[model samples]
Target chain A: MDRVTGHGADRSSGRRPVLTAARVAGLVGAAAYAGLLASTRPFTVEADVVTAVALVAAASAVVVRLAGDRSVPDGIGWRPYLPWLVMAAAVVAWELACFFGGARPSHPTLSSIYDIVARSEAAKAAVVLAWVGLGWALVRT
Target chain B: MTWRSVTFVVWTVLGLATLVVVALAMAGRGRIARPSALLFPVSTHPVVRVLVVLGWMWVGWHFFAR
Candidate 1:
């Protein structure tokens, strides 16, 4: 009798898959976020945005892998860090938009954005989608 | 019950559900095995991999970095 593994691989050969650090990190992050969602206050706009992004990122990753496109690059060198740079840029842009654009308070922190978006369902949904898309991109490359 | 109380109850349930799922994944048992198996590929993807890192960073940034 042969034991079948989740990836459709045969495990009867007696070789167990080794869990890598990256995989551990992903699992821990997902678990932590889910925990946060459950233990936090009424869903703040910022929390919602982050949740939406995580779901979208997870979904997109599933789709891409299922598509069977092996041509995707392996993120050589500094490519992996690009998303951090993008996030930093987004933070700066948020600050500038809040200050100069006058659409929000002088300091546009997560709390400020949450206060503004929490009240409006449409605004909240839109911001969630936009942030999720950015987050998806952040993960993609 | 007030909305806050209702939310608290709801979240408590959700938190339990999340804990169960995490536990299953950690143990690699039951129906979650397949999905847990897929996590390796998903995490390894160049793009998705970055999100994992960023997600952890986001947690720190939001909760501690202020």
Candidate 2:
């Protein structure tokens, strides 16, 4: 009951900021992406593109929400995240290109990209950039 | 049931089940609690990763296998 539902104020007192819709959306997008990646060839490249777009959009929504959230100040040191934001967009674009380039089964480059998404230069940089941004938020007033 | 049909249904069930469980679990936890507390903290971590891996493997088998 109370343990499962977390129906108290302390639930909001975690080290991290409260969960925002954007973050939730990002989680949903990730789950969907993972689930969809499993399915084989009946789907077209367009579907992959759609999945990528949805993920990036979900992530972008989180960024936008964070930026707009009143608790976050205008001069928030994390503002530098906007650049990483651009980089995130670029990563998604690269992913989309590789993923949807060919017709069925997608291009090898796309598979390679995903193969490394768990660990890739581009992916690593993007993830680092995001971490730096969050660090900025955490360290700043 | 055949393997193909079973795989689809498994994924379908897993995907839907995770969502329903997550939703109810999340909602059950007031929608504001950290997911860790809502779900079993230990099982939530590694099991989620395993579930993701297994879920995709199942989907791949469903889509491309002969």
Best candidate, lDDT: 1
Error of 2 at A74 (Å): 40
Please give, for residues A1-141, the per-residue lDDT of candidate 1 as tens digits: 101114244556797668988767755665555444434334476655555556556556646654665665433233323333444465555455445644333334455546555466455444444444444444453
List pairs with backbone clashes in candidate 2. A5-B28, A5-B29
Q: Give the candidate number with the greatest TM-score.
A: 1
For model 1, what is the C-alpha lDDT against the true structure? Answer: 0.48
Off by over 4 Å in 1: A1-141, B20-30, B34-39
DockQ in order: 0.06, 0.06
The 10 consecutive residues of candidate 1 chain B with the worst lDDT sum are B30-39
Which stretches in model 2 have alpha-carbon errors above 4 Å?
A1-6, A11-141, B29-34, B38-66
- Please give the range of 10 consecutive residues that has the lowest summed lDDT in model 2 chain A: A72-81
Model 2: CAPRI class = incorrect
Model 2 whole-model lDDT (C-alpha atoms): 0.41
Model 2 iRMS (Å) reads 16.6
